[model samples]
Each structure stands twice: as C-alpha cells, then as structure tokens.
Target: MSFKSAFTLTSLFAVTLSVAAPARAQTTFVDRPAELRSGTCASPGEVVTSLANLVITAGDPQGQLGATPVEQSGTVVPFAISDFLAADHAVVVQQSALESTVVVACGEIGGALNPDGTLAVGMRGMSESGLSGVAYFTPIDTFQNTLVTILLVGDGGTTTVAVVDTTVAAGDTAMAGDDTTVVAETGAAPR
Candidate 1:
C-alpha cells in the first residue's frame, strides 16, 4: 500500500480502538488478597456486613430472553462467610447455611474510610472449609454498587468463589436458599 493509504489505515484502527474501549469508568472486583486497614466502628458499634438473599436456578441460563430470571431450588450462598472489620482488629466469621453447624476463622484487618464516604477494606483469613490454605476478599465499587469478591480454598485443594453484590442490613436476618433438597442435610456445603 502507499504511505498515505497506510497512514489512513493506522488512523482508522486507532479510532476504532478508542471507540471500542469501555466509555464508562467502573471498578472491577477480583479474587485476590488485598491490603485492608480497619476503621473504628461508627458510634456505639454494630455489625455492618451481611449477605443478601439469592435463588440459584439450575435450568435456565438466559432467563427466557427479556423476561426476569426465575428462582429455583438448590441455590448457593453468595457470601455465606466474611470477616468482621473493626478499627482495631479483623474478625473472621465462619457461618454456614445450616443453622445447627458452626465454623470459626479469624484474621486481621487493615482498612480506612474513603474520601467519598465509602469504607475501603481488605481481609485475609484462615480457610473455614477445613483446608490448610488461606482465603481472600476484595470489595470493588462499580457504577451499580459495591461488590465483595470472595476467594475460598476448601478441602482437597478445591477452590470455591463468589462475587457478592447484595448486602443484608445490620440486625436483619439473612434468608436461606429456596432449595428444599438440602434442607435436611447436616451442614451447608458450598458449591
């Protein structure tokens, strides 16, 4: 091709790339260990973190085109466990879906309040799935909302992960899965 043609092609490619790139800025959540410095609890202190209700449907992946996604049985708890973030220390919470069983894991916290008023934090804790490895949590602020990406290492070198977007308000009870199959089981087994 001639020099002019080559230059035009290069310019066109650059323009295409610029246009194709994501126009809106957004935060991305990742399953990686992050550094978190804890902050003092607001006022008298209370539980500030929890999980939202989620129903996992096994059959429909597309939700019948434009229709809303239907809820099904055997759903997974997106964030069944998390560490408590305090100004002094980070406390790991090993909570299972089963009300009878209890698991405990502890860790340290490093976090601070962002200038935008959102709390920025990270925590690393011992595995609550009877594994020898560690687990990590990183919270990302996207245009929609903040999400916590949890990386969990279970027994036999198995890894389980979930990106938790919804949070249960403090002092409120977290709803259980709609799946009736595992309702009689001894404990909550994450998928």
Candidate 2:
C-alpha cells in the first residue's frame, strides 16, 4: 500500500475508535440538606452519675431503634436526623452507673425542621428524677450521620410559703407560718 494511503487509513481507524469509545461517567451529587431534632431531659443533678449513654429509638410508643453510646460531650450516630422526626421517635439517656438500664432522661423526637434544618425538643427526667434539659440533633453530613447533643440541668429548688389563716374573723386575716425558700444544691450533670 502507498504510505499516503496507509497513513489515511490509520487516521480514519483512530477517529472511529475515539468516536466509538464510551464517554467517562460524570459524577452526580445530590443536595440532601442537613437536619436536626432536639429534646430535653431531667435535671442533671437528679441523675445518679455524670456518665450516661444516649440512645435513639422509635418513640411514639418508645421502641428501640439501636443502641448508640453517647457521653456528656456528645457522640455521632449512624442515622439521618430526619428519620427520627416522627412522633414515635425518641432519644433517651440511661445512667451508666446503673449499667445503662435506668432511664434518667428522655426526650421525644418531634416537630418540623427549622428554616436552618434543625429540630429541638425537651428532655424530661424519668422516675421522678427531677432532671430537665434539652437535646439537639444536628446532621453532620448529607448521608446517615447525626450529632446528638444532650444538655441537662440540676433540680431547681422548691419554695414553701406560709399558710394564711382563713379561720380568722371575716374582716381580719392572720399568718399561720413563715415563708421558706429552698434552692437546689445539686451540682450540674456532665453533658
């Protein structure tokens, strides 16, 4: 074959290969917004210990979703915050001192995500522990990851007021006791 013809043939073959070859796959990224949900717990002082474990569960009736350990500082769990927004979802904290069996604090996961994609709820103390606090669920990524934050406060003391004697004459009233004020002296629980 002539060198010119051979060159032309080779050039055509190369162009055909290039055209037939598949294009590189283009990566696609989805915009999954972050989400958050928070709940409050009982006063930290009411908890027997500072150490506890946080669990995310199906809360309407309080079913276990999975066991995830979380310290007072906070911990990341393998879950999407939006999935737990159902009325039946809940976050609970069990006292480590009791082998994590005693529920010292709990909060139901509910409400819509805020404009910034966050949810907040109250955590009430269990077993009359008088504990109270808030939990904040924040999405760490677009995938299944959420940062659970639990903040608990001590029991706020109670106040007692003296009773006024109503048995006195219709025109006069008398104080039967003194006023007493009590402040909670318990220390704040670690979160």
Candidate 3:
C-alpha cells in the first residue's frame, strides 16, 4: 500500500539524515586533569599560580602559557601552572590555603571546531573588541582562532592554592604568546 511505501521512505530518510549529520566533538587530548608536579614545588602550601615567561614546546607560531594570576604572599603575581610540562590551557588557583598546596585548575571552556565558526569557545566567546589593546594584553580581535573567554568563575572557592594552566609548552617556535597582557587584575592574593 501507498501508506507502507511512505513509511519506508520516511524511515530511509531518517536514517540518511542521521548518517549525514556531523559527528560529535572528539577530543584528541582533552588535557583537563590538572595535577601539580610533586617534587618541584618549594613548600607544601606554596602555590604555583601563574605561568610567566613560558616557553612553548610545540606549534609553528609558538605560544607560551604565562599570564596566570596566582595568590602569592597575599598578592597576585604571574606564575606558572605546574613544575613543568603544563596543560597549556588550564590554570590551578588556590582559594584560601585549603590544603597543603592543594592546587585546583578549572575554567569555562568551549570553542570552534572548524574554521569560520567559533574558536576556543568556552562558556562564552569574549568579545574580541573587549580586549583591544591597552597594554601587553591578549590579542583578542586580531586572532579569532583562540580561546574566546577564560575566566575563573564562582565565588571564593574552598581551595586557596590553585594553578591556572596556560597550555603552553617549552621550546615552541612562535614566541608571540605571553602572560603579561592576558591576565586581568590578577586577584586578591593572586594576580
């Protein structure tokens, strides 16, 4: 019957639709596990807040993971994420000396998978215009293919010692990425 034929076509169409649709996002290496280097840290509570003067270990236009606002001596100074081999895109920050050097790395992350779309699309894309050029700041507008917005949300967390992962590596090619300009205000004990 025509009704049976119609149903068959519809089922086929549905199957085709699903097959043609784009696949889900696949993480090649979603380096979310932000663990600190045990031996390198000086003290138990001494936090590694930022990544300053980071040396990118890969990429053509090399990138560095600096620009982390860490809580240090009741002040925020640009520091590195880990003792070494950082995640390049994550940061570990301490809230209030939670545990002995108990560092935490968290932030809003999402981004463009393909060109002409979004990029480093975290919770939301930071208006590139918002970060024009005031000082040694992150290149917001010029480069659209980057993490749109990366800010530590939530109230003063329970943990005090944290590390902000810059995702940069050592011995990278392009020395264009630096932390001096990316971080804002830094913070109370971390900046």
Candidate 4:
C-alpha cells in the first residue's frame, strides 16, 4: 500500500510540473524557393532587382532632407520555410551591385504568415552605424501574385520613402510591423 501511494504521489507531482511550465514559441526558418530563383519570374523587369523613389518626408526637427538619384541594383527573393508554424521568420537579403552600401544583417520583418502564403507586416530597417542609416521596407500589396516593396530610408534624421513594384510571376510578399508607426495595416510609419 505504501508503494502504491508513493507512485501515485510521484505521478501527480510530474503532471503538475509539466502543466505549470510556460509554453515556448516555435522558431521559423527562411529559405529561397527554387521556383523563385529561376523560371520566368527571374527575368529582367519581372525580377525585383530595383527600386524607384516615391515620396520623401523629413522627420528631422531641423527640417533637413536630401536625395541622390542612385543608379543601384539588387535582388529581392521570396522566402521559403520548412516549418509554417514559425510565423516570425524573415529572411530577405538584398545584395547590392554598388560598393557604396552593403546589407549585413536582416532578421524578422515583424509580421505573420497567412495560410495562402501572403505575408503582410510592418516595415523595419537597421543600418551598419554611420556607414549607412536605417531603412524600412513596407509591402504595399499582397504576395499571392506579386510583391510591391515600399522602402523608407532614414538619414541625418530624415525619412525617404521609395516604392518598388515587383512582378514575382506568382509569389507572396510579407512586410514587418513597426511599433512606432501608427498605420493600421502595416504597423509602420514613415521614419
């Protein structure tokens, strides 16, 4: 009878410990889908290797702003994930052909993925100190077919927003959310 009681007590203790533990969030991964790297979508004009200046708003209290007509080029690839459960996975890399700027680290863009492969999040950007300034990328449309990238670059405490329309030839786009931005959709504001 003592053995049975001890065993029951042990089992109850184990159950209590397991139930009291906090739930952990799952980690999402990012991979470039082979389909996005090749095929008709990778062609010129169709590919998302460029950006166009749209709107610029100076956030500086001194009212200072500037813009250089940059003839820059880079590639923006769609993210492929092994686990769809991890919604915080952001793995978009922008490779520049110019020596003026290079993107070192790009983590999660602050958004959740939808069942249909549509990722819409607020825009967030980080720079490598004085080498460059923080730049935010916002998605203006859904990624089910194509991706529209809206970029807001911050320099000298000013903000410049550029709009780039990408023809993914059937792809999805996700934007990160910004806590500073009061936008109802992307959660990102021009910085």
Best by TM-score: 2
Question: Best candidate, lDDT-wise?
Answer: 2
Model 4 regions lying over 4 Å from their true place: 1-95, 98-101, 104-119, 127-144, 157-191
- lDDT tens per residue, model 1, 21-57: 5332111221121211233212112323333222333
Candidate 2 on 8-79: residue-level lDDT in tens?
A: 999999888877754422111111111122323332222312212332211111233222212233555556
Model 3 C-alpha lDDT per residue in residues 59-107, reported as the tens digit of each score: 2322332222221111122332111223223233332233423333332
Estimate the overall C-alpha local distance difference test score of candidate 4: 0.29
lDDT of 1: 0.32
Candidate 2 off by > 4 Å: 1-71, 157-191
- Number of colliding residue pairs in model 1: 8
TM-scores of all models? 0.28, 0.43, 0.24, 0.26
**Candidate 1 Cα deviation (angstroms), residue 13:** 60
Each model's total of backbone clashes? 8, 21, 50, 8
lDDT of 3: 0.27
Q: Which stretches of candidate 3 lie over 4 Å from their true place?
A: 26-39, 48-191
Q: List the residue pairs that clash in candidate 4.
A: 109-176, 119-174, 121-175, 121-176, 122-176, 122-177, 143-172, 143-173
Better of 2 and 3 by lDDT: 2
Q: Which stretches of candidate 1 lie over 4 Å from their true place?
A: 1-45, 52-86, 89-91, 99-101, 111-129, 132-145, 155-191
